[model samples]
Target: MSIWRSYPRSLKVLLLAMLVNSTGMAFLWPLHTIYITQGMGKTLSEAGFVMMLHSAAEIIGSFLGGYLYDRIRGKRTLLLAVLSSACFIFIISIGLSWPVYILMMILLGLGIGTIFPPIYALAGSIWKEGGRKSFNLIYLVLNFGVAIGTALGGIVAQFSFQYVFWVNGFTYLLFIFIVWRALDEPDPVYEAAQKKALDPRPKKEFRPLQSFYSLLILCLGFMFCWVTYIQWQTSISTYIHLLGFPLSSYSALWTINGLLILLGQPLLQWFMDRVKSPVKWQLLSGVIFFILTFALLSQNQSYGGFVTGMVIMTIGEILIFPAVPAIADRLAPLDRRGMYQGLVSGAANVGRTIGPLLGGLLFDGFGPLVLLYSCIFICGFALICFGTYQRLQYIQKEVSTVKVNK
Candidate 1:
């Protein structure tokens, strides 16, 4: 099926809006560590700390955005976030004092965090028929945006740092205006689903707190899986630089990662859907990721070796990343979809929060090999967690079957 056929007009518009927004974000992401450390003259530790703060703020934003999305319509909430993000970008571009920079980071995190729940909500609502394919398309568009954004940012950063932020900010402005004019409220079906959940049906009372805790654990496991990967954005550049590559080369490597995702994710999704076992896909991917991370350590300081490892890592990403949202959707009650998705993003932020700080400490004290070894251990633990989750799911299914038979 043509991916476009799966979505209606309004959803198409929303997807495009997300594409534009993510493209803008992609411009800043790979360059964020570079900007703070090289452009702004902060230490590696300082930059990592700032990034942790940003991710921490995102955790709050994700929760708040998800909560508000459940109560309010998504469009209004999204508009507010887009506007706030634009304002934050402008402020951060001017190179404020430490406190102001920290404040701006919080706002940026909140604004960015707000974007995901609505986007995911829209995808979940609009493409109910398409199932995993719909989510995969959304993921595809997002990665495409990242590819374009990172490639553009890398090229621009080669000439001027300010241009990266300016372009990113401008794109956000464009996204805000486009979404304001183009996207409508969700379709009636989704609206009805929202209303139905509130109509007091007693199938299983939606326990928001219990579901939230479950999602939190899932997110933490996700964090453990991804903490190592996030370092590719922050410390890996410095590590590469130490190996005698120019800063621009690091950016190019990121662009390569994005490109691989653009090419690989859809195919991976296709394979994943056919497998009939999301948990198995996740566990296997985690194990592969662990092995690949260890291989990266062996290739330390070799440009070819690093690129090869990154390619393998990207393959693991293609398998693991898209599976997350689908898994969350299955675990969450319909009423709590927004909050569960928020937890997923928040857990990722937690991973982001820990990844860079730990990576920096490892690189500074123990060196690159230690960091890679540590990542192997983290991925190993995540693999075990996923295995257990799968087993529990099997047990639950068996119990449900027994009850139905009785």
Candidate 2:
């Protein structure tokens, strides 16, 4: 409570907006592959292809949002993104045939993608001192929304998926209203940060270009992480259904994921606080867990096995997801914060774009064992990438020191 009260007004609103946004998204996203596969009688491969397209669109949107935030500022850019998303989502709620449904989903991805960079950028801008705490708080709230939304979405979907679509659309409308009312105010803090960012001088101690190289490397690992992670939503969801688990049971997995994340925050914070080079350790250790997740999945087929795998996966998610943005925040030049954040988001989307298609094809062609083993192999590469990333950062610092001594 004390910590919550300590946040700046804009950050508080940003957190609220993120919560609302993610909750709405959760209502539909967990069900997307399910709907396409069963409701429309599409094959898993077809559903994967559609999801890939949607994620590709989101990549474009992430870039556009970052550029817009850096250029026009967040207020107007956010309004445009939210308004467009709401329109697309409303149309989706109204019902459509296959091809049309596909197109609307892609467009909705664009809108949703644009919303994130600005929110993340603004969180850093508003509370410059908050550092990892700010990103973690945002992440915490996001999962809370997921927890609430997924649980409710499962129930609502039991009755009718039409209502699920409507609920998602309504939340976007609510987000628009919040932005209009709360975010329109003149923010002196953000304005001051913007002005500082415009300064031509570089911080000699910090190398923006080199740091960005590191960020790109980190993002590659992030991309791989998402590739493995997204299987739960894509192939794994369908696989569970084939195993005879109910849709509500599948959705409950996500609910458990979200709830566990919420419950585990304090422990994560403690671990982080005590760790040396926390973010690096977080990435490395998380990838290890990701590998373990798939390894377990390859062997087990029961409900208990799935739950245990999810629990392991959730721990990796807790370690990895929030830390990536926090690292990006640290590395970004004040002027390029939005751009850096965008790249991070875009990288994740790239993984998402690939994951579904790859997982589906692997599952269809080979089987679940092959799919799970493939994920484990990819996660090994992720571990290597993050490890190499830390090494590069260390080398960059040494080079900078040499230049300073000269």
Candidate 3:
């Protein structure tokens, strides 16, 4: 497609690598709760706890990944990340046991989390002018990988989860190959920034503290949105199983999610092109849709109802996820880009860390209705956070202008 070719060649290569990585990860993620609950004979609560640990690990990985990007650059950081992920995942394929599975999942999370910030940072670096288009392409390829992986993952799972693990591991190996061969170190963007920073003349001062404060506000909102969103992967998947629907049915929801995102991109891009304050509007509208999704889920108990919810949720997802990173990219200083992006990723991981444990507690204590309602309330909080993030940035800009005038 013309859209694909419009990106820089290196970015295209990075995108391909991302696609491979996401596909591998997808093979296991959609089925994680199910594997723990049914395959390992564990309770939902236990599965939730394990997922919590996994996400907590990701928080560390996300931060580390971003930090390393600024220091070491993308190519080396990527190779380090994927190599660890592959080793852990391969061990999982062979051992396929209980306590070991937990350890491996946490380690895998670290590796996987490390992989993303660089991919995103590289995309931004490779095509700075692409704006939302840059991050959106990464998101698109991500879901496209999800679509392929989840579909085949479901089939592979029916045969043996071991095969799923092996397939996932193999993909990571493939990802390593792509990254080692394709991506270059000390990229043009980084080199250019380094040259500018190293210049002898005085430089215009940047608002590091204010920008950082804004990023914190943004991350809070991002974390909350993820907190609610992640329930679908944890609690809701378990609930679907409890309702006696097959694993494939649950997997189909993600499949639909990815497919809708892929197929609906043209329409989404068209609307984005026409919209005012597109990032702001996209996030606000997305939170509203998330609320609608949970509301619908609370009332509807049928398979068709779940299908409908996934469609609604995917729309919100398409709008929100890419915009958050784009906002971070906008807010970051030249040298601190990776650190800022890492914080954003870490925020999302924090939500993922909390969601499963909280959802599990709610599901275990009060039941599914309470869990669904709670998610809707969390979405409401996320809306507040998003609004506050915008407000802070606006105020900071106004303050800066006044000082400049004085």
Candidate 4:
């Protein structure tokens, strides 16, 4: 099928909004922790705690967003999230007090939470005709936003913290207007059909418990991977600084990771589609990431080593990240897509919450090498879990075939 076939007007509008929203978020990405710790004079532990709180709020918000999307209009829920986010941004820019910052984190988490489920639902519902291609396109564009946001956020942070908030607020405002103008709610027939498909009373009842257990196993691996990624963003700069690099290199690192992701995601997607089993690619990526991270610890002071590590990690990320939603699509009940997406997102959030705090503690105590070793161990455990999951899936498939023949 032609790639452009998925580019209907509504999908186009949603993608554009995502681009703008992401660009705005990029302004905040590199600065949020820096501003709290350095600019506002909080301790590393304090900053980590705040981030943990933010993640907790995000977990709540994501699940709530998913539930709302299933029951209410998608557009209304999105608008609420955007507006609420704008309010938090205003508070962050103005108050800058500790209590206010904590409150804003919770509110902002809720605001951001509103976006994921509705956006995924919109993509799945609208691009029903495009199938896997549609899902791939959405993943590609979302990562594109992430790459741009992280890259630009580093550049912008070099200027001023306030500039980041200003850009973030304005982008959100623009996102609200764009979404309002361009998108339409899903058709009622489409909604009803989705609900029917997910109904548990069908010949083959939807197995929520089984799916939940499967996701729990998958999430254990995801938690480890995400913790490693978050640590790279949060503590790697400090580690490099201690190794005698200039402070400015921090931004450069973020820029490098973002640029690689921007360039790599589409190519990886194309390659994975041609490969027979996504599980193989997922396992391969995890192994690559583990090795590169180990190598990075051995050459702590070498700029070349850092850059090589970043490249290797980015390749692994390209393979692993998009495969997550694809796996969710396969595992989820047809009608409960939003819930499945929420669970996946929530698992990542849990990882994000723990990663920074744990990394910070390790970096401060035993140093960077210890942190790297911890990451390698966690990832190794994740790979073992993935192996178990693969074996179980194989058995399940064989059993299904036998039943079908009977």
RMSD of each: 3.9, 3.4, 3.5, 3.7
Clashes of 3: 0
- Estimate, for each residue in 1-406, the C-alpha lDDT of model 1 and write its tens digit: 5956756777788778989998999999878888888887889778767877788888888888778777775787788888889888988887788778877987898889888877777676665555566566678888899878876788999988888878889998898888889887765566667645545454433344444555555666688877878878757777788888887777667667888888777776666667765555665775677567566655667777777777888887776676677667656666577777777777787788778778888989998778778888888777766655545445555776688799
TM-score against truth, every candidate: 0.84, 0.88, 0.88, 0.85
Candidate 4 per-residue lDDT, tens place, 11-49, comes to 878888888887787678557778998889999778767
Model 3 C-alpha lDDT per residue in residues 222-279, reported as the tens digit of each score: 8889989989987999899999999889978877887889988658866787865558
Per-residue lDDT for 131-184 in model 2, tens only? 677888888998899877876887899988888888988898898888889974
- Scored by CA lDDT, what does every candidate get? 0.75, 0.85, 0.85, 0.73
Please report the TM-score between candidate 2 and the true structure.
0.88
Model 1 ranges off by over 4 Å: 33-46, 94-98, 154-163, 187-214, 244-249, 274-279, 299-301, 390-406
lDDT of 4 at 66: 74
For candidate 1, what's the RMSD? 3.9
Instruction: Report the number of backbone clashes for model 1.
Output: 0
- Model 4 CA lDDT for position 140: 67
